[model samples]
Target: DAGVTQSPTHLIKTRGQQVTLRCSPKSGHDTVSWYQQALGQGPQFIFQYYEEEERQRGNFPDRFSGHQFPNYSSELNVNALLLGDSALYLCASSLFGTLAGGQETQYFGPGTRLLVL
Candidate 1:
């Protein structure tokens, strides 16, 4: 069974350019969440999608958005990216209908590292 996977392990771009990262959730999972992890900080939740609808979103601006497909795969898109956007974009999967101990213990994938110049 496949767990989770991401593409383009590393990327470099200039400010104002857009970037798209991909993710495939573990088998038998139905929910996907996107997170941004800065250099010395914990991962911050961006948004979560369940049943193809956005269930919860964090304080991130509109520039951070994502989508989930019927196959439980997801894609995170950032528009007009800024230099501050440079960070590790992590994709996590979990079961939506039920919460894990009141907190989701997300299974993560090797994030796509983003660097902005």
Candidate 2:
């Protein structure tokens, strides 16, 4: 029953470069969501994937994209990255349609820290 896992625990890149972050969901979880958390800010939703398709997205620009595989693993990609894009990219997993009575819990990964110079 491993929880969500992310790759490249830390990364450094320059503006305009591209970066890809990976995540593996917990057992029996079908949905994967990505979030960005700045140094002192709470996590902000980037997007969510279910059944290998993107189901929801946040206010992020088109530079941010993602994909989910059949095995419930996911990837987050950011193109033409900006300095402001530096943050901790987090991955969360949960079962879709299990939010009974508005109670749903998501298990999160340690996150990949990206630094843009």
Highest lDDT scorer: 2
**What 10-residue stretch in candidate 2 is worst by lDDT?**
96-105
Against the true structure, candidate 2 reaches a TM-score of: 0.94
Per residue, candidate 1 scores C-alpha lDDT tens digits across 1-117 of 988899879999999999999999988888899899999999999998888888889999998888999898999999898999999999999887555422356799999999999
lDDT of each: 0.88, 0.92
Candidates in order, TM-scores: namely 0.93, 0.94
Question: Which clashing pairs does model 2 show?
Answer: none
> Which candidate comes out best when scored by TM-score?
2
Q: Candidate 2's residue-wise lDDT over 1-117, tens digit each?
A: 688899999999999999999999989988999999999999999999999998889999999999999898999999999999999999999888756512147889999999999
How big is the positional error of residue 50 in model 2, measured in Å on the Cα after superposition? 0.3
Compute the lDDT for candidate 2.
Answer: 0.92
Question: What's the residue-level lDDT of 116 in candidate 1?
Answer: 93
